[model samples]
Target: MLRSKLTDSPLLKVSRPVSACSRCRSAKVKCDNKLPACTACEKAGREKECTAANDQFARGKERSYVAALELRIEKLERRLGYARSMKDSVALNGPDEPPAGDPNRKDSMAFIRAAIHRKAVQTQEDADINTLVSDFGYLAVNTTTRDFEPSESNMTFARLVLAASTNEPVPTPRTADLPAESTARALVQFYETNVIPIYPVFPGTLLHALVSDLYQQHRRQIRSSEYWLFWMVLAISSASQSRSRRDEHYQHAVEFVGRALPHADRALRPGYGTQVQSLLLLTQYSMLDPAHFDSWHPIGFTCRAVVDQGLHQDPPHIQQMGQDALNERRRTFYCTYALDRAISMVHARAFSFYDEAVCVALPSPFQASSTLSGSTTAKRSPDASLPLFRLRQLQSEWYQALYQGNPNEHLPDITSFIWQKYREMWEWSERLPPDMPAAIREMLELELRYSYVYCIASNARGAQVSAYGKLLIFDHVISYVDRIYDIAKLAENAAVYTYHDALRVLFMGSQFVAVLQEIGDLILSGSSIPSPAPGKVLPPPRPVRLDRGTGDDLDRSVRCLERVKLTLRLYGDRWESALSCLKNFEGLSAEVWKNLTTRQAMRNPAPTGQWLPIPGA
Candidate 1:
């Protein structure tokens, strides 16, 4: 009866506090322990800020409960250990009546020994389990499971938790600190390792997951300014190449930029300033992928924000970083160039919106009427209006000339306009005193060179024709070489000069020859003609070489082929040189020869043992 009464008593029950605050429980009426009012009072339209005190008594109770549980577990473990020790001692002592020379008895004893050992092991294991549980409370099981075999996702989660708990910074990967070439190589390696192998079997989700992981991993390593820019550029280039998977890559890259943009904007280093431009370029590239267009509106917003911010602020210090010192100005120039390219790409891709601005001259009749007076139009003679027609005719001619292989086609109207602009620029140059800054001179020179190259490549009669319809195409082969030569001559450092000179000879020189050979083929084929000479007798059209023997023509072909081969060798695995050569021979017959030779050399033995020398050798 006493036991029953004790069991039924309120003291025997485990009860928790009714309120977290003692003051609230003390009040007969419901009290929030807030400074002035409770939730009920506030809900009744009373303006009050709640100020509740922490329940110290409740915390003490929780601590005592946890301690008691731990003590109980420890006492149980100790009792189990003692019981195990007694069992082990009894097993070692064997049975009271020993069966001498009996194999069965010996086997029984061995079994008992084995059982004793196992029990000892189990006891130790249990002790360890108890210790772990006591130390880390409920986390012991999870920790043990993780330690057994951690998956990538689990590891990432663990790392995030650790970072959060300890407020630790994450380590940057080695590839993240590498140069542009190294970064590109790493990206290629990642694709080869992760993407290429499963490409045939897993065409969709798995491949996308791997690529997404790679993008995320790379995004994390972007610590330094250079690496960040490199990553952005590499991502764009990689996405560009991944035609089938471009949309997936584009989305991943957009997400990357979205996260990085805030950090990049706050960065103060000038060398790292290129990251803004790179991010802009990435946005433009993402916009080009149709799948991402709808989801990536933030790209446009970010780009405009960056542009607005950069233009409004002072120019970055281009000459600060050590490695950048050599090409500081060039890097700065490229930063601006990249921005322009991004803007141009966006304008081109989103044509419907920007097309009107670009085609200002082709305004609607109503719009033209609004801007022009009838009296002024009446005063202008019909013949005077002929010049406008003439300009259009000339523009069309220029377009045709550019398409064809003509090296000297000039659109009078366009050329005249360019010349007028050039004259104005020259006047501006002259107005600059002799003591103008070298940077200003260099800028003017670059502008002049760029404009000249633009005109030469675009105005050439056959330039557009052979360019295979790529707009704004030009013979950069010759101009690139010329610029390299010019830069080499002016370079003060011997190593820099040699590098530039070698690059020029290896890339530009070979490319110019290739294009010239292509032009020769087009002329010989009688498929096209050179531009008309100015006030000079037009050369009789050369007959097409139909049955051209494989003798001198073949020999010349072999030499041209050999020249390409030798140039490739001289360059020695130089991709820029090879790429420049390829670009120059874009619309040419010589490219076929070079490509075939290269392919054959890769697949089989070389026909000729001797390498050909550079032209004029």
Candidate 2:
């Protein structure tokens, strides 16, 4: 009966019905789109005959608002029942909540206020959660995880990594901390010229827009990602050029990092693609500013993001995406891949994931975007990062085979395999585009030599390294140490060299010294060592030196050892960790260094009017 009465009511109308009543349609008159009855029908005294023409219901059985009204009524009825039940519960003497003779609830108004307070606290908690979620820019980060909630404790991924890795707190910036607009632009120019060509994780256009917006337009409207990007670019560019810990560039880099961290909670919020990019930028900055942030921590986070996001593989249904999306995804993944390989190798640690686990293809040809300032990155050749990406892949392949997957077992043809790897890298280096910037080109060349020596030097694998292999290590390490030292001593670094480079120097120098210790005669004798497999592809020939220094074996070896010290000492000025590497290297080679000094001293003889050669030469 209730249903019938509700359906019969002419006022039972929806906000906007789809069609007129049957009578109104038959009469060929305009309809008000009301339900149950048309106004024309009521005026015609035919209200009993009114029915919607296009109702998706049986006759005499439907009301337009039935579901909505019934739901509302049910809710009210439920609340009414609950309110009656709670009437006594809200009282001071309520048996459910108040303890016997509790002084806290002695006053009647106190109990009422207590009930209201309890409800407000719940509502406030929910509001806080919502506000927190919204502040993360909800689209970029998932704040729904219970552990990350404020109700539990104050902890976030950003805080976790920053705390673990940061050795010193970045100084908070003052209003005067910002450099002049032109100075900022020049720094950005440096980053694009040196850093972007190697990583290319983000589009240049977006950075350019952010720089213009920050300087010319209102800064308040800028987004968190924009601010993070801008600040990190400045920080990395400055820190990369810093030759001393006390330099202005280093100080300014720290200041910019401090400014960037406030925006990091949002920028690095996980569960979004931007998370990987943001982490990559942090890794780049951390490489330059290891005192403030550890590159290892950020790169580890980035690799985790890549695996979690399935960026290690090509998209299954790639055609569904736009070309630009596909390229950016691949580019970002490869950038992370490259950094992981480089950092892990530098630290002499295992890679986050092996090459067999990753299948992402190289990104498409680059489409350079012009910065607002109209410089750099734009002039570089497209696909400038591909060479580095390929080299990392090659490094990963052998590093995994030799050091990680099965370090105990020797490969079936280890010698051939080593030479093959060197050949592949040599080809990669030889193909460097002539049009590439000299700075970036030089950086790639350095990486190639490092890889060659790193691969050839048999560290942990059980097989005894042949004399030829040790010779390869000797020559390549010399080339790498010499060039890298020159670059480190420059007033301004042409490329991004970091504390990681210092670590590499230690490793290469150690290898060079170790080879000399074992075979000081054969290596320093200027006599060629035959390949272990005479018929097979010969081991890479000795490095053809451009300047064969006029010295015997002992003199050359001494010079090499001294250059290693000078290089580490120079890098030590920039990174505190490099100083640590220097000390450690000195400790490891104490005996070898002492013997070399004694030998040189006895041979050369004191004050026979024999003066030492210039250190720089």
Candidate 3:
């Protein structure tokens, strides 16, 4: 029913008149609403720059977006300026020919500029990769999934996303706000004596020189990348020492690393040894802060830097080079290799560099007697790291065989494979020097034991057998558990345990508790188990000295798990992973205790001295 009356239609609202000219709007300054140009832009001698806001601009009100765009434009402008300056320099210098007499410095200056240009380009690529993959979208998922289907890639991407999403913004450190000299010195000293001995990757003599120079001069005078590297190293090492200062120092390290990163590309152009050392230190320290965006990413760049420097190759004139430089190159390359292998293991990613392509020598078996400035003397000594690296390399082989290969393909049965690896690891341990320091020996021995337990327990389903066989394996693993606890106790007494060491022990201990809980379940179920081997007969289960576990035994196990939890908490401040591990242990203990308490309640009415009968007896 349309009324034919002359109803007035709503007036078409005119588009809101542009309130501020584009320049004024961008700067968030007031515009006088003047025609042709705003009064603010005219007064600022930018009259031509003022224009009406674009009607199509959808996000004009977003301050952050505008700011980001402005920043990008500034960066482009600065880069343009740099290109112009470089062009001028090239023209003036005329390609940097060697001086007329001595020809040793053949086009050295030209090469330096070229290298700097190359690194700058590479640095841009590194940054771009981060921006491209930071979102962890379908691209990252698809790429990783395609490379490693039904394998670790999906989990790896998930972890990376977890790491990224949970990361909190850290405050940038001001150079003027460094720690007091005395405090800095003490921390550095602790690092040199305690932390450096374990990794032994950084050159002690070179570090001494850097420290001397740093303290002797003003911090402002030494604003180079190497100085920043030293600052970061000091911060991370100090963080490892005390919980009270851990976060503060780690934050400082993070900030310093960020500032030094832009200079990293240019610094490497000099062919100076500090560049490699600094990158290695950063990569190593990054491992501790798992939540950092660049934590694992820097390792890839470090490897590229190493390869660019030809560090993987042993020069034919190695003897002619400074002995210190040569040895440092060797140490740095192996350390990188070790780190690469470890990261691959942790992230389940493929190793960036291959061992077959490596040609660098292993670090000398003996300790460096004096400074690098002095004789690079070689003497016999019990170097624990030599064997440790060997063990790690051996461990890496297992990873390659298991993960790098197709998961669907038939491989060795888990038991036989594990047993073979165990035997090999045991033989490898035998080769370590008998007289090695207890500090080193204990950790290495703990790793071996932990590896055994990890392998057996990880593949427990594959080793399924009758109840008696599970009991025998349980008995064997329990002893290893006891050994781990004993070692942890010793470590508790000693102040030398690093976060990495504690984390390893806690991880293994937690798994051990889990295995025990599983075995307990099997005992209660009274279920028949198939033999691990199809046709082959297993040896009769070994007779154990211990009797069936009673209430008291169950109570003891609970107390042991509680002790492990308490130990993990001791390290919670220095290592965030400790808290996560503690939570896991708590859950496992709660479940195990609940089951035990119920069993105890059922048995309460029976004789106090009676013990639960063994299943499958």
The per-model lDDT (C-alpha) reads: 0.34, 0.70, 0.52
Give RMSD to native, each candidate. 27.9, 20.7, 24.3
Residues 131-202 of candidate 1 have per-residue lDDT tens digits of: 533333212111111121222122221221221122112223223233344444444343333222111111
**lDDT winner among the candidates?**
2
Of candidates 2 and 1, the better by lDDT:
2
Q: Rank the candidates by TM-score, best first.
A: 2, 3, 1
Writing each residue's lDDT as its tens digit, candidate 2 over 1-617 gives: 32222222212111112345667667888765333455688788877888754342344543332233344446556655565466556644443465445556556565665567556544554444333322221111222222332234345556644654465678878654456889788887777666776789887666766777788745658767678888889888888777789999888888888888888766766565567888888899888877676666677767766765778788899899888998889999999989988988887877766665577888877744223122543553656788889889889888877887555454777767778888888888888777665666777888888888888887567657888888877778777877887877764444457778888889989998889889977765668788665535567776787447547767767777788899999988888778888998888777777777777766666685777643223
Q: Each candidate: how many clashes?
A: 10, 0, 0
Question: Which stretches in model 3 have alpha-carbon errors above 4 Å?
Answer: 1-131, 134-166, 174-182, 217-223, 244-272, 291-294, 308-325, 347-349, 368-381, 412-414, 457-506, 521-556, 588-590, 597-617
Tell me each candidate's TM-score: 0.26, 0.72, 0.58
Lowest lDDT 10-residue stretch of candidate 2: 7-16
Candidate 1 scores a C-alpha RMSD against the true structure in Å of 27.9
> What is model 3's C-alpha RMSD?
24.3
TM-score of 2: 0.72
Error of 1 at 262 (Å): 13
